[model samples]
Structure formats: structure tokens, C-alpha cells
Target chain A: MEQTSILETRHLTREFKGFVAVDDVNLKIRRGTIHALIGPNGAGKSTFFNLLTSFLKPTRGEIFYNGQNITNMPPAKVAHLGMIRSFQISAVFPHLSVLENVRVALQQRLGTSFHFWRSTRSLDKLNDEAMHLLEEVGLEHFSRVLTVELPYGRKRALEIATTLAMNPQLMLLDEPTQGMGHEDVARVTELIRKVSENRTILMVEHNLSVVSNLSDTITVLQRGTILAEGDYATVSANPAVLEAYMGSSAHD
Target chain B: MSINRILFWFTLAVLALTAPFMVYPVFLMKALCFALFAAAFNLLLGYAGLLSFGHAAFLGTAAYLTGYTVKDWGLTPELGILLGTVAAGALGFVFGALAIRRQGIYFAMITLALSQMIFFLAVQMPFTGGEDGLQAVPRGYLFGFIDLNDNLSMYYFVLTIFVLGVGLIYRTVHSPFGQVLTAIKENEPRAISLGYQVDRYKLLAFVLSAALAGLAGATKTLVLQLASLSDVHWHMSGEVVLMTLLGGMGTQAGPLVGAVLVVGLQNYLADLGSWVTIITGGIFVTCVLLFRRGIVGELRALWKRSF
Candidate 1:
């Protein structure tokens, strides 16, 4: 298959108060595939994700999203370019109903958000699209329920639903299944797999089993640098990968 | 569309319209004016989570403009009111931009400092008549022929303006823009991530609130035929805050109920002199400590449970 890179970083680096949080990292995410970035605590995976999504401006280097340099663009503008990100913790309007939450994102895409006088009900197509997105995320039944009232796992799902409302070409999921029960983790992992069919998905996963089970390619990071990158079978068996996971073992 | 909520608001509006017949028209008019003031304040405090301490600038500025124009310039009441409202909105645009640069307590402090500066300016300005204010300002014809010198006619006119202002606020809150304001209040960062220009929304809300407060203050000046230092003082700002807090911080009807109660207390206790201040202060403390949800908020909460 021809390699079509959806997102690429050229020697990306970020420094905070004299300490390098993300150091000289190079990454390439192929179009239409699930790529997982896995590492131990303090390995800077989250910082790397932040840099990619333009939440934090990179100290050095360039980010090319679909061949456009978006090094220091604001997150909202970056999101408008078919890239959307979901937080490790659920980020949503708790006071808004599930449907309203999705509708806001849908509104952003439709360019009808600033029409203050027209009743929001007039945007029937947008509402239907929002409901469809909710349905896809299995939240259609809880459409009118306030987001704060939703179950923890369901809220996480709703976050994805909201993100999906933007119709992003590339979806960034930071620990998409974190802090979930075994059942929820499985359900979310399955959902992520289903979502990955059309859009390229780059996610940070702590659970090796989930990564091995879902990721087509895995990149291992340790101390702000990529330790190993390949298919799960090859990287998981690499001595460096094993040492990075175990610590000081591969050094000996 | 809920029957109870609809009936409740309908009944309240009817009572507000009719209360002047039973109670002193002047006192009812005062309450109506303050109700508009409190509602405007609540637009910022309740929806945007911005606690302004200089709202009196808008009120007093409008009052003075309305008073000076009607008294000295010989403008009609409606034209004078328009001039006042426009001035308030213009002031809000400038002050809101400056105040919104800082958030939380800093924003409140900035507004307070600006308003205090305006108050001192008003005290020295010759047009405001210093401490004496611009008294004996003609009420002028409401449209052209309807005389406003009659106390009952004046009360109804004030009530009509108050109702219009409140209705405007209600429409604003139910609008989609209002939802975005709530979203910003709940979590500004999240709203930004979702592509909202939060600061712009906040500034607009501030301007709208200021204009409405000006409308109230201008109406009050017409009612009393004076625009004095009391309208622009820091105490007036604090009073609005108290009204909003006493009624319910974010609830719509809270400010109205809070304003009416405060206004009525002041009218009944005017003969008690300095005790009015102490009593109002005591009520403020009690409301903050015990009845923090205010009358309408408490009622809504109760109604929600029953349903």
C-alpha cells in the first residue's frame, strides 16, 4: 500500500522554563490507520500530543498536517483543518445537555453559530447531524440528559461524539480508554476501532494488551525520544522496548 | 412550556403590573426600576459569572444624561431616555473592554475604581448640580399628549419600560448566544477549545447589561425628576450585587424578586433612617449565609424535586 502521511512532525521540540518537555521528536502518522504511542510515566507522550495538536507551541521544528505547516496555529484553527483532539480527562460542558454539547460542535462546522436571532431549532439538518453523531457514539438515548449526569464512561464516549461532530480527518485520542473498568475499556476500544475505519487515529495507550490488540503500528517512547517503532509483535520483542518497559535491563 | 413555570412567571408579571393600585405608586415604581437594575446586573453575574463593582457608572451616567437633557436641554422623555441608554452602552464598550482584560476579583476591582472616578467627577461637574443634583426635571409627555406628571401615569410608564427591559433580558438569556455565555462561565478553556471567542462574547454581554442598567437608571431619574450622586455611588453597585445574590446568582427571576424585596424594605424603613442601612446589611448577610439561593431559585429547586 502507498504510504500517505496525514500528520508529520519534523524534529519537534518544546521547552518549558529551561527544561525540555518534548525533545527533538520526529513522528509520522499515516492516513487511515491506528497508531499508538506508549510509554511509562514522565516519558512526555502527553506533551508530544499537545505539540501535535498545537495546544502548546513547539519550541523548535514544524508540524505538517496534510502537507500544511501548522507549527503555532491556535488549537481551534488547527481543529478547523480537519484535526480534532479529545483530552485524557473528559472535557465537555457539564451544564449543557448531551445533544446541545454535540450541537455546539456541529454548529462550529456549519458556520451558523453567530446567527443569534434565528431560533436554533431552524437548524434542523444540523440537529439531525448532531443526533446522528450521538447515535454513532451510542448516546442517542441520553440526548437530552445533562452531561454532568451521565456515567463516567458515557461522558468519555460523548467527548468523542462531540469531537466527531467536527468531521475531523485526523482524531487525536489521549488515553482514550483510561480510568475505565474492564468492560468499559473493551467497549471504548471497540468504539475506537470502529471510528478508525475512515479517519486516521493517533492515541496514547498505557495498556499494552489494548495497544497490541488494536494498534496497527506502535511507537514506544522513553525520556522524550522514540525508543522503538514498528508493528506490535516486533517492537514488543525488541530488547530496547523491553528495557524501556522494564528499565535498566537492556542497558546491562 | 412547563405549565407551572409558565403560570408562575405569568402570575408574577400580573402582580407586578397591578401592585401599584394597592401599594404606593412611587414605591412600586422604585421597585420596578431597581428590578430592571438587578436584572441587568444578573445578566453579567448570573450568566457570565462576572461580578461587576462599577455597574453604578452605567446607571448614574444614564441618570445624569436623562436628567440633564430633560431639565436643561428640553428634550422629550423618550428622547432623553434614548440618549441615556446610548451613553451607557458607549461607556460599557470602553469600560467592559478594559475590565475584561483582568478576570475574577481583579475585574470587579477595576470596575469599582472606574465607577468611583466617575462618581467623583459627577460630584464636581456643574451640570449634575453637585450634591443638589438636577431636581425639578420635567417628566415631559410620554409620547406627546399623555401627561407623566400624575404619579399613577408615571408609575405605569415606568412599569412598561421595566417590563420591556426585563423581556429583552429574557429573550437574550434564552437566545443561543446566551447558551454560549453559560458555556464560557462553566468552563472558558473548554469553550475556547471548541472554537468560541470567549472574550468577545463576554464583552458583548457586559455592554448589553450596561445598556439595560442605563435604561433603568434613566427611567428612575424621570420618575423622581432628579439624577443625584446616589445613582452613581459605589453603594448602588453594591446594592445591585446584593439584590442579585439575595435573589439567586444565576437564576433569571432571582434578581427581580431580590430587587423588589430590597426596594420595599427601603421604602418601609425610610422613617427608621440609618436603621435601613443596617437592616439591609443584615439581610445581605443572612441571604449569603442561609438563603443563598434566593426566593426564585429556592422555589425552582423545590419545584424540580416535586416534579
Candidate 2:
């Protein structure tokens, strides 16, 4: 109910047949902050993200965005409400030029996505804006290259650029750096930090170092429920949180 | 468009303009109609990545409607074609709305089932003339002025429509709308997460393609002077698919070339009887095994590599 909270979930629960993937849980993401959700494998991080974006229906509970109930809003309509998301894997239009990839996102704002009779040349108006997004992602040089030709790290960066094209207020990034070298990880980490300004980011990151570096708040989940919630120092030092990560019998 | 591409189209146009002098106009008109049908099918398959196995419904429905209107109602050729095209579009909207929820082979099967339903209806419908078909469909005057009675004048009329249909396809492919369709084809989920109403885009593309296919069917009814059950048969749907795939599913000129080649073989090899189907099947299999992108696609790849 806090005014600063841009997104809030109450008792959100999702079950796959008999298995509960995302248990009854309450969470809040403050405006203009980077919040990271971390857990062990199969901890329901993805399911929770899917539920938040309404890509998956919650068995029980409600989601509120900016004080409006958006529990069952369609994914595209949610996106139109400025809550954009990136995939766990790099998702780009492989055959389109990198510039065209950004342009597709920008084109939605033109209210002419259905105008089959209009020439694509009219899209030239968005070229400068699209290039600026590319430049922000450090991909201006590769704008003309087919997206499939980009290196793995660059593709993730392009995904970010496309997401940014929406000028979203809230961004849900599912493993933005899931598979990358140290160099790519650092570059994407920095890019995320740069783009996170004046926006709210909810990320599911596996890398502890990246989590410790970027997250303003960290929530740890175990068995589809939050085990601990605090700053890195506080949560990392929690005995139960350590038990979840390092195992219960580590000291015994 | 590139200068080379423009020149290529120009060359083709010149050839088409002068071809009737050396070849039969009726045969050429037949090829042009099939080419238009194949091109419309390609718009869904190649660009939108939807494979509808029931496209003949649109073609057949339009053909029959145009035939009835022109023959019995004495409507002008243009009005009959327009009515047919619009009816086909409505039918497409229904089919697309139902089928788009499924994908890949299932989508194709849904279309095939719908087309078969139309085919049986055609067999029983009174106005369709049953097995004998609605024959003696007069070409009628163009716009109540220029006579389409003469074969040459009729050929010109058909040619103009073919160019406009193909030009519209070209424009649709290169338009902003086309970009979204391509995006949906490449990655449907990604297109949705990026805020596109993916289903709506797919439906619109389907309807536009169906209308164009219907236009071809309606025009053919006038040219052939008959609206037959064969036009709406499942075989007709399959033929358009084969033409598109053999021509090059996504290429601009692939369907046109494929239609001409197939129609030419069927005409010239008429004495061979059922062997024409066998030969066409053999070529299709060969094309799939060797150059899967079809003749035009393979040639373009070769030109790219050599240059």
C-alpha cells in the first residue's frame, strides 16, 4: 500500500496440477529501484516473474501496479501499460536488421502497425530514435547487421535496447546475463545499471556478484517462498539464507 | 526497390506485353490467374508464416459468386469480382479467427478441413450447377464501356489486375505492417511481449491474402467462361500450395514462375494424361530434396554468391 511501491503482489499463488510453483507470497517493488529476486534452481523465480507479467495466471491472489489491479490483464496490454520484459534467452528478430529490430518496438507507438498499404519508408522517421537506443546499448556500429549475426553478448544488449524503446516504467528481466563470458557479464551489468536510472527493474539474476553490485533490495526465495529479504550484507549474513544457499548440514 | 530489381520487373512486363502474339492468350490468362492465387497464398505462408491448406475455398467461392452475378444477375465484370472478393474476405476472417489459435501443421489442417466443407457445399449448391458447373460466364464489358469480348482486350484486362494484385503484395511485404508480420513469424512470443496484438496482425494478413486469392478466382471465372466444382476442390488448394513452395515460398517471383511452369506442363503434356500429376509430384520432391527454397530462391542465392 506504500505510495512509493510501483508494483505489489498479495498472496500470489500458482500450482501446476498438484505442484505449487509460486506459493502464497506478498512482495513489493519500490519505484526507481533495482530489485533482484534470487533463489536456487527450481525455486519458482521464473514462475513468479511470469505471474507478475500475467503470462501465467495465478491460482490465488492479486497484482497491483501503480495502485490499479492488474491481476488478469493480458500480457500485451500490461506491456502497453509500460511494464516491458526481456526473456531468459536472448530474444531478437533474427532475420531483421538490428536497426529494424528496434524500429519494430518503436513502430507500436505510431498507431499504424495495421497500415499494410503504407510504405515502410515512413518508418524512417523513427530511424534517429532507434539509432539513439542502439547507441545507448553500445550497438550503433552493428545497427545494419542482421540480428542473428550479432555475438551472444550483443544480442542480449539489443534485447535491452528493444525493451527500452517502449520507455517502460517497470522492466522485468529474466536472466539478462544467463550465458555469457566475464567480459560480457560485466558489460551487460554496466548497461543494466545505466538503463535502470529513473526506472524500476525486477531481475532474476543467478550471479551473486552481479546481484550484490546492482540490486537496491534483494529477496531470497526457497521452495517457492521468500526465505529472507534485506540488503546484500544483511541477507547474505542471515543464517537461514546461508543454509538455503550452502545447505543445512554444511556446519554439522 | 533496387535499380536492378526495377529493371527485372520492367523486363518481365515487356515480355508479358508481347507474349500473346506468339502464344495463346487464353492459356496465358490461365497462368496469370494461378500466379495471382499462388502469390496470395505466399503472403500468408512466406511472410506471415501461416500455411493454410484451404485457400481454394476463397478462390472457389469467389469464382462461383462472380459467375452467378455476371451470368444470371447480369452484373458488370468489375462489380462481380468486387462482390466475390469481399465475400471471400469475410470467409477468410472467419477461418483466420478460428485457425490462428493453432499453429504449424494444425493450422494447415484446420484450413484444409474448412476448404473441404466448402467443396462439398459447392457440389450440392444449386447455383453452382453441380457437376456440370455454371458455364457460359460472359466476360462482359469492362466498366460498361471497353469490350472484353475480344480475347486480346480480355487478356489486357486480366494483365492489369494481375499487376495490381502483385504490386499490392509487394507493397504489403515491404510495408510497416509487413514488418510486424515478419516479426510475428520469426518469434511470436517475442512479438507479443513487445506489445503487439499478434493474433490481430495474423488475422488481418490472412484476410488480405484471402481477398487477393478470391480476386484471382473471380477473374479466372470470367476468363474461362465457367465456374466449376474443381475450382473449389481440395485439389485446387493443394495446387496453390505446390506452386508457392516450388516457386520459392517467400520470394517475390517464385509463385509466378512456379504457376507458369506447372500450368505450361499441364497444358503441353495434356496427351500424357494422369502422368502430368506424376511428373509434377516428381519435380516437387526433387525441388524439396535439392534446393528447398524453390527455383527462384536457389537462383538468387547463386547470383549472390557469384557476384
Model 1 agreement with the true structure over B60-134: per-residue lDDT tens digits: 999999999998898999999999999999999999999997998999999999999999999998899999988
Model 2: residues with Cα > 4 Å off, grouped in runs: A247-252, B1-7
Clashes, model 1: 0
Question: Against the true structure, what is each candidate's TM-score?
Answer: 0.92, 0.97
lDDT by residue for model 2 (B1-307), tens: 5999999989988998998898999999999999999999999999999999999999999999999999999999999999999999999999999999999999999999999999999998788999999999999999999899899999999999999999999999999999999999998878988999899999999999999999999999999999999999988999998999898999999999999999999999999999999999999899989998899999999999999
In angstroms, give how far residue B32 of model 2 lies from its true place.
0.7
Encode model 2's per-residue lDDT on A112-143: one tens digit a residue: 89999999998999999999999999999999
For residues A1-252, could you state the per-residue lDDT of candidate 1 as single tens digits? 225998899999888899887888888999999999988888899999988877788989999998888897887688778888888888788998999888777776556455445455655567788889998989999999999999889998998898887788998889987888888888888889888889999999887778988898899888888889999999978998787777532210
Worst 10 residues of 1 chain B by lDDT: B187-196
Top candidate on DockQ is: 2
Worst 10 residues of 1 chain A by lDDT: A243-252
Task: Write down the lDDT that model 1 would get.
Answer: 0.87
